[model samples]
Target: MRNLTQTVTRWAPTGTDAAGDPIGYTRTEILGRWEESQQLFTRSDGTEAVSRAIVYLASDVAVGDFLLQGSSVSASPPSTAWRVEAFRKVENLRGTDSERRAML
Candidate 1:
């Protein structure tokens, strides 16, 4: 679709075959919007904590496997890596293939 939020790029970490063979780098394409959220909370010790997460639409290809937090998605060059904290399934997005939420 023409109105996709951003181009999600996946960089697969090296994999090993059953015979102990090496699998080269693999790149895949996923489309979604990467957003940053912050929440402030007070602890019992009166300490403040800011929770940050990069939220995005889950990828149909990854299926939440072989995905690490250090990887990231970018619309252009100079990307930033985000940690994968949690994932939740959300309403089906328009013009998208998956209906899940990813907390990076």
Candidate 2:
């Protein structure tokens, strides 16, 4: 993780309303520490994907949850969001304090 930290708002699904429509994710939103990087990830099926950013929090998250982040520029109000496509966890190391990596 990098020292350049940013705020992340995670929106999780709550439930539905009267007409079987999706309701609020207000109570489901969670804030976390996020960092931006330029790392590419490889999948089990031999496919490659790029992750625009990363979340450093340890809380669990599901697919389709919204990830909100403020723009990098200081004087700009533009922000971006992404859906959780998938996540991967890797473990094992020779000599390092960190032994695991969680990629999304």
Kindly report the root-mean-square deviation of model 1 from the true structure over all alpha carbons: 8.9
Candidate 1 Cα lDDT to native: 0.48
| Candidate 2: worst-modelled 10 consecutive residues by lDDT | 70-79
Q: What TM-score against the true fold does each predicted structure earn?
A: 0.44, 0.49
Candidate 1 lDDT, 1-104, residue by residue in tens: 23446766655436667986535545555666665677554433566655465545545433222232333453222235443344555554475455555554
| Sequence-dependent TM-score of model 1 | 0.44
Q: Name the runs in model 2 displaced over 4 angstroms.
A: 1-7, 14-31, 43-46, 70-79, 89-104
Q: After superposition, how far is residue 51 of candidate 1 from its true place, in Å?
A: 5.0
Which stretches of candidate 1 lie above 4 Å from their native place? 1-4, 14-25, 39-51, 61-79, 91-98
- For candidate 2, the TM-score is 0.49
How much is the lDDT of residue 55 in candidate 1? 43
